[model samples]
Target: MVSDLAAAIWMYTVGPWLDHSSKFTRTGTLGGHHLLLLIIALTGFLMLAALAVLTDNFTHSTPMLAIARNVACVISVIALTGLLALILMALLSRLLFGPLRP
Candidate 1:
């Protein structure tokens, strides 16, 4: 999670702001990096969700197993929702601010 957040910051916030504006004559917009960061962050979040689901095999009792599985199920739902939202944001950002062509 920390790594994902760092990647997000490095790609979107730091990279874009630090880019020399004068280079626009050579390079295009920096929004693509931000979008890529979002995708990576979302992937990490989804991976966490998968890991949570896979943790259900360590139960000591049926009741405890049920509770743990339930919690994992809920976490999975939230993670999937987060992944979907991230994908939507990436698509929208690209639509709104993709690179311009000559």
Candidate 2:
């Protein structure tokens, strides 16, 4: 959709600007595992959305749509779990790493 494309464009354009200005560093922060998890979770979400759109022509009561939606919902739940784990990990890192010195 146009909204997703525009948001992606905005993030691509502005993400680095925000990161640089914020002096954001991954050191003592999230590790590669966390990043990989986030990427996989996001990929799952996109695939779910694409599946829904691709199957839009099918009748709502069809078994295929039901199966697709159920699968997508399950994948979304997994993605949500991944995101929640990331948040908890980030919080733990903050507690463990302590605040940056002024």
Candidate 3:
């Protein structure tokens, strides 16, 4: 997770910001890298949610624990669905934009 976050920051955030405003002419807009970073962040958040539920798995027995676990599962599913949708949107935009610029 830490590596993913670091890669996302480098590949998507700082890299693009430099390319956009660096010592050169530019016709920049928010592009796929930003979207991809968002997708990565969302994925990490969803993973954290899953880890929370998994950690709660062996809690012997408790009503509130079960409820919290179920809620986390549902929220994770929702996050997953949103992640898929974001991925599809990114793909479609890439298709429309053609190959990525150097």
Candidate 4:
């Protein structure tokens, strides 16, 4: 979860700068690239929150704790799946479009 948050922070902060530095033109005000980064960051935040809740409930052995853990697990899985999809998409794009040159 921490890692996810870190990655999200990096994407939200550094990713755009990296793109700009590469000399790629900005697609639009709210292009697919920007939207994708937002989605990834949102997912990462959700996963981090879920994990925090799960850990906070770890000391208890109540039904709510069980529920929290389950919910966290689901959120974490979803976040991981989204991240994996993005990675695969990146790989496919690289293969199809070839490497970005600047």
Return the top candidate by lDDT.
4
Q: Residue-wise lDDT of candidate 4 within 14-35, one digit each (tens)?
A: 5575446533323221232544
lDDT of 2: 0.48
Error of 4 at 44 (Å): 7.0
TM-score per model over all chains:
0.31, 0.40, 0.32, 0.42
Clash count, candidate 1: 0
- Tell me the TM-score of model 1: 0.31
lDDT of 3 by residue, 10-100 (tens): 4455546634663321111123344454455556555655555666644553676567656645544543443355457668879999878
The 0-to-1 C-alpha lDDT of every candidate, in the order given, reads 0.48, 0.48, 0.49, 0.55
Top TM-score hit: 4
lDDT of 4 at 71: 65
Residue pairs clashing in model 4 are: none
Q: What's model 4's TM-score?
A: 0.42
Worst 10 residues of 4 by lDDT: 23-32
The residue pairs that clash in candidate 1, if any, are none
Count of backbone clashes for each model? 0, 0, 0, 0
Candidate 1: segments with Cα more than 4 A from true spot: 18-32, 56-102
